[model samples]
Target: MAWNEPGNQGKDPWGNRGGKDQGPPDLDEVFRKFSSRFGGGGGNFNKMGVLLVLIGAIIVWGLSGLYKIEEAERGVVLRFGEFHEIVGPGLKWKPTFIDEVYPVNIQRVNRLNASGLMLTQDENVVTVQMEVQYRIEDPHKYLFRVTNPDQSLSEALDSALRYVIGHTTMDNILTVGRDKVRRDTWEELEGIIEPYDMGLRVVDVAFKEARPPEEVKPAFDDAIAAQEDEERFVQEATAYSRQVEPQARGRAERMLREANAYRERVVLEAEGEVARFTQLLPQYEAAPEVTRERLYLETMEQVFSNTSKVMVDNKDGGSMFYLPLDKIIQGGGSAPMVEQAPANRQTSTSSSGARTTSSDNSTGRSSVRQGRN
Candidate 1:
């Protein structure tokens, strides 16, 4: 028969001997039964369970301390909110609760931009843009030295840029002096951040743009164009001077040499004539008459050599004649003879020989007869 048939005394499946309310089982009895199944007394059961929990907690804590760092990163370790030590790349471990590790990318290059409208030395407002590229050098200083290193670097860039721009001119900033501005800003930025020890290194500073305000852009553009044209013109003029100067100097040198040569030739010829005349003077002083006669004959011979006409005289007082030999030869004809009247002819007898003179109408000169002995 079933237990609930109401024919026997009060009893239940959980071993409740008597109860007004047949509720769930008792907590203390359930614990005692579970301890007995585990083969431990109640006190030993509690202690063993606590030991297992503590061991698992320790394993988890030790496992949590193991961390990995990338090749480009450096690990910064902190102990109880104080900087401890820096760790390099690869697998690393640190105490979980006593130390903290922050991975910082030391090899990564970071960039910041700075731009603003600033007043120039010439009191002109110009907008300038600059870019700074940097990388972390010391991870410890980077994390601990400053609260916000990046923001500090940005502010430093701005300060440096403003200082440089203020000392420069508008024309230079907008045109040829942009590189100078970039370099100066970089130097100034380094100086500003040096004291702060921001743990930032400037890799490069690029001058992106520098221009006048929009309202004056066109005028500045025109001014910049004029400056470029002026530079080009100056360069071209310098090249031209370089090219033409040598030729001009060469021409001047050549003319000077030619003039010197001409002067020397003239002087040498004059000296030769003087020497000849000096030697002739002595012979003329030795015998005046003979020298005079010889000189007169030489002069006549030299004069007649250049003419084509000839004159002849007959010692028997016959008719005198002139022969035009040049015209006869050129015309391929016989010589043409011309007779002269005795009244028109002139004759003189020298001590050395008989002399006869004939007139040549073509050259209007008198010729002395040569064959008379």
Candidate 2:
């Protein structure tokens, strides 16, 4: 029954404890007590923690300024958008809120083109197109000194192209002076950009296209055709020379070879004939009579085979000769022999009388033989 008292409810539900008032709490006790009412309070806090975090953030952003620049780039620092200074590659720093850095492309080449229908020095309109290659040499000047550098570059290119083409003839721009036009335009454009404080390094310039206006396209085509014709003519001439020179030389060589062969054959033939004739000449000298008789007989037989003419005279007759007129009249040789020689007044009347003989040889000489006894 006493365990049921309100004051004793908390105290002696298990019985036999008397109640007493608690003392004032210490600082640790007060905190502990408050924390018990609240949950996990003021456990992980230092007074400098907020300040430390702000300082850490500042340090992180500042250290983050340590950046590398590429080999082909240049770093420039701007303080509140004003040109502060230039920086180089690798681990560079600047104050975060005050200094800003930009890495400019220093070694990269950029391209620009100027193209349009423009007027030539001859007051003819033509389309001239050119390309320029450049790189940034001064980042500060490239960034700030010029207003819209790219647009300025374009305008400069346009101006240069127009001016150059204006001073150049149509034929020059189309053919013999194309390189000059490109080079002069580059030089002029570069000069314009430099004077205006745009820091650009001009690398090279080239002509992409240049031609007469569309209205004159037909004429231009005709000109090109004529030029091609000239080139073709030159090529054909060269080809002809190349072909004809060798052919002529070959012909000359063949002729020379033929002449040499003919010369050698003639020389050999002459030597053989000389040796044979030399052998025959000695044999004739050794036996003149026998050789002569044999030659006479052989020569006589050759003559009578083609002609028949007979003449007779008395053994003792003077200045007289009688041809067999009856046989001659009877067509003995099918035609009477006419006397082709002068008539003589004498004739031999002996055992052997003068007779004319004729011989034919299929050789070098024909002969008439006269034998008398």
Candidate 3:
């Protein structure tokens, strides 16, 4: 009953004749059967499968080409390994394995430092440190214009620093000349980079430090201190001069004004004397004796105005008088009595009396003649 039995050998499980002699099913028949199950004929199945494969391939290639750029970045596109257009930040598409995109961050600032012991114009050695802040201005140039922009910038910084330091002095590099050194270095760097077009812009150049060699540091410090002292003294002297000069000028001006006033007063007084004498000349010439007597009295009045005086009237013709009034006043003693005159001459008194002066044993006599009315 089994199909593999000798009698059933000629027939297969599917009831086909000579089944043992038949190999596997025919390729054309298998294809026909598989296509019929999917409701497609043989040729249409092959074409549809090929179309689906092509579409999948195209989709994979397109997705592979899609890339993104950040807000701060720029894309440098290279088509077929050759330079192409630069693209801004956004979703970008390029042929897969054909065009390449290199994203560069243009907004970021980069820093480089250059330092070395350099020689100055005066042949002095100084260690100088400088820092350069820079940023990429052109991403294309930064990527292609120069093999390495950063390295180039660093070299330029070194060259600029050295050149500036070479032209400057050690004292300036270490002290007040720091700003000048930084500025000069910046200018020199810009000049050097300008011709290269490295697409790098220098933001700032900072002079970090400049110092003498360690072996001479102590001596330099002493020198710097001495320079500071000298400056301080000069400033103090300048301030003192500023303060004192004005006072001296004011005093000198005051003295000049006083001298001028004194001169004016003396000139005026002399002129007044001259004028008074000129006016009196005619009067004196008219009455010489009277004028002379009046002048003598006026002069005497002026002379005795400020002194302590004793007045004595010589009523008798002759008399001896003695007085120690100065000693009596100093010793707080009594005054001496007046002595009687001799009887030979008559005693006379005038409305205006004559004055006689006497000390302890000395006497001074003065005569006066009354003027006629």
Candidate 4:
């Protein structure tokens, strides 16, 4: 709505718009709104005044270019889209809007976790979870020295992870020295990140858990359990053998050795008895009468010790003597030999001590019948 419109006219003392009906403003109001606002005429002079005012305002804004950097951060100054300088944490300034300041945290560290299931050198896949801690070393280099700085971390981490896992067996990744693997991964990751000028230094890497993936977890667990059981069984069997076999062998050997020693002792005793008997045989031979008398008395005593039997001789002249042999034939004793005696008994009397025997048929035995003899 232009003010010059007739409907927009203000009322004066006669009820009309003041400025529009009055046609423009006083010259002093124009001068006051013009030169005071830095414009002279509609010519080049007015344009110069406007441009000068803009330039002066820009100068004032440029002088106020100051910022405070925290203790953990540094300022990267850019002059004309190029690296101007790197400023430490403090009150610092740049050349107004001409120089851009990028504040980068240098003291504080950042952490990231790289975790996944990956294949190992043994053609087995395992789940690996871990954390990585890093800090920015050179802030200026961190911003400009590397392209896609933030994304570079994952690539370097992947490189390190792959390198570490690729060289490790599945078992080692799942157990044993997983901590050392994480440390090695951090060092390798730092090396890769550093070369790219990502301004990241590795503080540490920790493995949360590394194990067989879910698909093969059961199989691995079963295998481990089976191995332990097998080892236990082997140990038990070995211990049983170690405990039982030696004692059994020792017992058997002891019994055999004892039997052998007893055999040797009995043989030595028999040999000694035989030698003594042989040595006494000559003495008995030289004194035949006395040895015979003593033998007779000893035999008589031994024979009568268990029985009251007595030998009787029947004095029938020509008749075959009927011997009373039944009395000596009773009880537990060696059967005494009897003979049908006639001429042999008369000639062999002294040698047999008045007893004789002969080889005969049943007729000789009838003479010594149970009741008849």
Candidate 5:
């Protein structure tokens, strides 16, 4: 049967001993009873609750301010909307509502790329692509000094690149002068950023690509190919010259040395001849006739020593005798021995009708001697 039936009109499903309708128990009385059980008044309990709430809030605010910065990052702190100290990599804390922290990856390399069509110094148009690598050197300046450092850097890079490209030739942008263009752009970028103090350090600048526009690429390619061929030919010629020059120089040095040796030999021979003539002059002056005869005999003997034939004449009988000196020389005899003949035989040797006579023979024979040719 239902509890709110006619006989139990004031009674309900909840267990209440009275017939009057009742709501839930009062919260203030419930808290007051709980505090009485804890041996504290309601006012003291309220104060303790407030203290616990305050401590909990303080702990939460402190934990909320804690941050960890990685080894590659730096933290820039701002206090009351003003620049504060820069923090290195570590766990750090800041005031919750009064300070703000910005973590920047200072160690990480960041890259910005710029590419566009630019007019060159020679009034030619070309496409250039470049990349700038940089790092944050000072995080404080990076965060506060510029409104947008990355965008500023990109604009700076573009300006520098265009400036360099405008001052250079299209061929240089596209070919052998690429390194120069890259270096100039880098330097220009540094100069542009230095005055602003952007707190960015440019690690490197790479000129990634440069090319003529599509409408003129083929002609430019042909020109570049021709230039490459010319450079190759020049390098090959240089190498060949380097290789051959030493040999030519060596030949010239050898010829010079041989000429010097020949000159020295001729000079020494002339000096020797002069010395011999000087020694002979005194003897010739002491006894002119005897010396002249001796000299004549010596000269004749010297002349006949080179002949190949010998002729002997027997003066007593007017008979001529010929010795086959050429045959004798061919028979392995280089020299023939000449002796005084008998009294009846007179011997003479003539070299091409030249004669030398010897009269002091032991057998009273006159002898003329010659030599083989």
Candidate 6:
């Protein structure tokens, strides 16, 4: 039956007999009644609920502090806005809202480029570009030693590059001096950053490119080409000298050997002549006239050995007959043989004290010569 029926008048769901209207149950009363079933009073139940809420808040705060750091990174911990400690890679924990962690990649290499048109020592302007490779050496110094280490390094690079370039000439910077410029800039950069303790380590400095201004590029190109040509010519000349020197030395050595040989031969021949003369001195002293005649005959034989003439002695007179043996050998005809004339035969004598007569032979006509007695 409905509670509002006449028979059920003055009765409600909560077992109240009065017919007055009833509103919803009070929250406190409901809690009190629910707590009563759990063997605790309302006051104790409220205390337990407050404790549970505090525990939940503590758990959340603890979980928020857990973080992971990669292998290449180092975590810098700051407690209450002050540097506390440094932590390595892996899972780490810090008090939430009380400590801050800044992760720095210590293993990564950073690059900075500095380039511009700068004046050189020779009052010439050149465009220079350089690249600096660096990495963090100390996380603490990198983060706290300077306001901004990266920016400071960048500025240092520029300053060092400018200083090096300003002390170098345009020709060197654009050509052979680039390597020196890079080395000097690296050294100067290290010196500039060392005292600052910025915790940055320079890996390398490379001179990217150096060139004259566009307006003068063509002229510089020509100069560079000429310089290269000069070097090439010098190298070629050096090689030629190296190659020719040995040959010239060898030729000179050969000539010296030949001259020495000739000198020795001449000296030996002269010594032989002297020895022969000494041996003949005894013979000449024993028979002066005969030795003199033999010497004259030997000398004359030696002198006429190379000639084409033949000499014949007249036995009955102190005269000589001459004939061109070489001409006769060349088919000019043999000399006529002179025969002793009989006393009855007439003889003709020439101015040279030789009798001459024309005779005919089987071959051809010949002029016969005879010495006068």
Question: Model 1 off-target regions past 4 Å?
Answer: 1-39, 260-373
lDDT (Cα) of model 6: 0.81
Clashing pairs in 6: none
Write one digit per residue (lDDT tens) for candidate 4, span 1-373: 5555556655544334654445544687766677655534556666786899999988887677878888888888899888888888788767776888999988777877788878888888888877777788878778977776667786778779988988888866765568778878987887787657677777778788787878778988887687679879999999999999999999999999999999999999999989977986887899988877777766665665553333333333233433334543443333333332333122112112223333247554422212122
Model 4: lDDT equals 0.69
Tens-digit per-residue lDDT, 1-373, candidate 5: 5665556654565545444555655788878888999898888899999999999999999999999989999888889989888889988889899999989999889999999999999999999999999999999888878899999999999999999999999877777899999999999999999988989999999999999999999999999999999999999999999999999999999999999999999999999989988998999889889989788767766877665433343444323434444655465643343433444543335443323344444776545444221
> Scored by CA lDDT, what does every candidate get?
0.80, 0.72, 0.78, 0.69, 0.81, 0.81
Could you arrange the candidates by lDDT from highest to lowest? Answer: 6, 5, 1, 3, 2, 4
Per-model TM-score on C-alpha atoms: 0.64, 0.51, 0.59, 0.47, 0.71, 0.60
Q: After superposition, how far is residue 204 of candidate 3 from its true place, in Å?
A: 2.0
Could you give me the TM-score of model 2 versus the true structure? 0.51
Alpha-carbon RMSD to native, per candidate: 10.2, 17.7, 12.3, 16.4, 9.0, 11.6
Q: Against the true structure, whose TM-score is highest?
A: 5
After superposing candidate 5 on the true structure, give the runs of residues whose Cα lies further than 4 Å from its correct spot: 1-46, 288-373
Q: Once all C-alphas are superposed, what RMSD does model 6 give against the true structure? A: 11.6
Off by over 4 Å in 2: 1-49, 80-82, 231-373
Q: Please identify which of the two predictions, 3 or 6, would achieve the higher TM-score against the true structure.
A: 6
Misplaced by over 4 Å in model 6 are 1-42, 253-373
Q: What's model 2's overall lDDT?
A: 0.72
Q: Candidate 6 on 1-373: residue-level lDDT in tens?
A: 7776666666787656764665555788877788899998778888998999999999999999999999999999999999999999999998899999999999999999999999999999998899999999899889999999888999999999999999998888877788899999999999999999998899999888888999999999999999889889999999999999999999999999999999999999999999999999999999999999898767766775543334444455533344444545564543434433334442322212223334476756666555444
lDDT of 3 at 129: 92
Better of 5 and 6 by TM-score: 5
Which candidate model has the greater lDDT, 1 or 3?
1
lDDT of 5 at 16: 55
Residue-pair clash count for candidate 3: 0
